[model samples]
Target chain A: MIAIDFLGAIGRLFLGFLQAIGTLSVFTANAVSHCVRPPFYFRSIGQQMLVIGYFSLPVVGLTAVFTGMVLALQIYEGSSRFNAESAVATIVVIGITRELGPVLAGLMVAGRVGAAMAAEIGTMRVTEQIDALTTLATNPFKYLVAPRLIAGTLMLPVLVLVADIIGVFGGYIIGTSKLGFNPATYLRNTADFLEAIDVITGLVKAAAFGFIVALMGCYHGYSSKGGAQGVGAATTNAVVSASILILAADYLITELFFSK
Target chain B: MAVDTRIPKVSLRDVHVAFGPKKVLQGFDLDVMPGESVVVIGGSGTGKSVMLKCLLGLVTPDRGSVKIDGQEVVGISDREREPILQKFGMLFQYAALFDSLSVWENVAFGLTQAKGMTREEAKPIALKKLAQVGLGADVAELSPAELSGGMKKRVGLARAIAIEPEIILFDEPTTGLDPIMGDVINDLIVACVKDLGATAISITHDMASARKIADRVAMLYQGKAIWQGPAATIDKSGNAYVDQFIHGRAEGPIQVEVRA
Candidate 1:
């Protein structure tokens, strides 16, 4: 009986996981469908862009700068043993443009924008504002979900571009001021090692991460029930799901782009 | 050829909806005439709100149909549902005002966003609707979060009527207010519905609110309308469930689910 009960519990857990994935898949398809359709809400899209992109810049920038600075320091320390400290500039630039810039920005925005969207939409759900929108002949997907998805997908690339520049600049500052390296030589090395594909991959990853963050936020909030506690749970679920998906998607996207 | 002109404003036919193991509504049927105020009264969790949601297409019944003006709304596409939904406005239990929007903006939401009217054009109409609900122009620019409970209800009512919807739904209109404020909201609802000659359906457990706003009363129990009559006759409904519910009795055929 104990063995059977344990098996049953495992079965239940597996089913729950499949169910959540199924629901989120359907939600993403519907939200994407709305994104490509006409009668597009330009104002709502613009507003969401401001929230998801503009409002998130400071945090993403701060994160990228710190990561770049730390990477330069660590690379310099490790390379000095082999008398290859000059490699710090190239490695920092390549790392920031190809991975750290997009990943860090995506995670930061997931925390800031994803949680906000979930909390805002969750509160609206509990209070029936979403229903109110329905009664007023407004489609909640078109009105609420689509704009955020579009903004998240489109703006994250731009944010990643900005973060890449800031991150490389951070490495430059650390290499020149802290490591006593010549600024011009470090800048030359950094620029020479960076490629268009490296930045493109990062931007693509940013876009995917943005989509995941918004999608998770909306899916959890739209399905939230109970009351304030439900909204709170939705917010937490959105952030956790978004962050996990961001990392998973980053790996998948990297495999797709760079696989041998 | 004679034309049949007496189409019910809203009708639910053999509706059944269940959430997992719990059945909220079963074989629920009701036909509301145009320009009538039909209030549904029942114990908490007896599907009063579910019935309303079904009519609005917010909740789809597992079986049966919801009709607006004798036009079947069940399984309709979003494009088809839009025109039907345009005819409805709702006042939610907690007013459900969009906290991000100003009071005037909230009232003007459907008009400007859904109806494609400019903000400049919709402002006067929103202000007029607000005034009709006894809200002053001074309150227009304030955010929904800043309003008192009674004031929020008034703003919600104003938003409901802003588009002059053919049907208005009130979901627990008096649930969270003081008795006097409740009565005030009730009176305002009556006045607004009367002036527009709109069909109104209200779901509430408050007997006093039912007496004030209802032209007719329906009592739901265990997923069915167990008793229904003119509002004046609710006190003498004679059904055991209705009696137990209205008088707030602990001992009756109706059982409260108390979990330890």
Candidate 2:
């Protein structure tokens, strides 16, 4: 009887997983359908771009710069043991552009934009603003979801590119001025080590991460139940889910791009 | 007063809404006439909001038909439903004003976006609506977050009437206001509906606001309309559920769920 119960529990868990996947697919399909049809809201799209992209630049930049500086110091200290201190520039450029830039930007956006989206939409759901939108002859998906998805997908690539450049420059500044490395050789090594594909891959990853972050945020927000507690839960879930998905997708994309 | 049956403005026949196994509304039937204000009063969990949502197509009834002007809305595509929706405006329970936009912008949102009016064309109309709700032009530029609770409610009312919709929905329009402010809002609601000659449906637990705003009142309990009559006859409703609700009596036919 105990074994049978255990098997039942496992089966229930498997079914729950499949149900979650099915629900997510349904949500994605609905969003896509709404996006393609309609009385398109270009004004909303532009406004969201300003909110998600322009307003987010300062924080993303600061994080990238500090991360780059810290990374340079760590790489320099580790390479010094092998008498390979000069390799600091190469590692810093490659690491920032190929990995850290997109990953960190995605995570930062998950915290900032994802939480904001979830909270705003979740509150709207609880307060019945979404219903009000429907009563006004406006499709909530077209008015709310499309602009957010578009903004996140389009803006993250630009943000990641900016972060990559600033991060690499930050490493260059720290390596040459603070660590007493020859500036010309540092710049030359950094340039020689980084390829176009590294940057392109990072940007591609940024776009995917952006979609995941926004999709999770909007989905949780749109489906939020209860009242204040529900909005709070949706906000938390959106941030956590976006962060986890970003990290997981980062690894998967990396494997696809660089696996042996 | 005899029931005037000249083609009811809104009608719900055998409406049923279920969230999986839990039935929120069951065989709910109602008919509201043109230019009439109907207030649906009920206990907290009795599906008053669900009924309103179903009427607006925000929640699909699993079984039944909702008709506006004798046009069947059940299973209608969103595209087919737009014109029906365009007749409606809603004042949400929390005043659900867009925090991102200023007061006037919120009022102007429907006119500019849904109606394709220019900002120039929308501003004066927005200001006029605000004035009707006793808000001034000076308050127009302030963000929704900056407003007091009563002010937000007034702003929400202004936004609802901005488009001059033929049907207006008020979901708990007086929930969070003081009695004096609640009366003020009720008065504004009456004035706005009268001015537009609009069919109005209000869901509220506030009996005072209901008496002031509704020409007729319906009591919803256990997923159905239990008692409905002229607002003046509520004191003599005779039904124990209606009696228990209006008097706020704890001990009666209704059971309040208290989880230990």
lDDT of 2 by residue, A95-199 (tens): 998899999999999999999999999988887778767776778888999889988899999999999989988898899889998989999999988899999
Candidate 1: clashing pairs of residues: none
Q: Score residue A186 of candidate 2 by CA lDDT.
A: 91
Model number 1 iRMSD? 0.9
For each model, chain A TM-score?
0.98, 0.94
Instruction: Please provide, for model 2 over B1-260, each residue's C-alpha lDDT reduced to its tens digit, 9 standing for 90 to 100.
Output: 69676988999988899998899888888999999999999988889989988878888999998999999988898788888887888998888887778999899988987788999999999999999999899999999989999999999999889999888999999998999999999999999999999999999999999999999999888888889999999999888889999999999999999999
Where does model 2 sit among the CAPRI classes?
Answer: medium
lDDT per residue (tens digit) for residues B1-260 in model 1: 68537989998888999999999998998989999999998888889888988878888889998999999998988899888888999998888888888999999999987798999999999999999989999999999988999999999999999999999999999888999999999999999999999999999988999999999999888898888889998788788888898899999998888999
RMSD of each: 2.2, 2.8
- Residue pairs in candidate 2 whose N, alpha carbon or C atoms collide under 3 angstroms: none
DockQ of the candidate models in sequence: 0.81, 0.63
Candidate 1 residue-wise lDDT, A1-260, digit = tens: 99999999999999999998898889889999999997798988999999988989999999989999999999999999999999999999889988999889988998999999999999999988999889888889999999999999999999999999999989988999999999999999988888889988998898899899999899999999999999999999999989998999989999999999
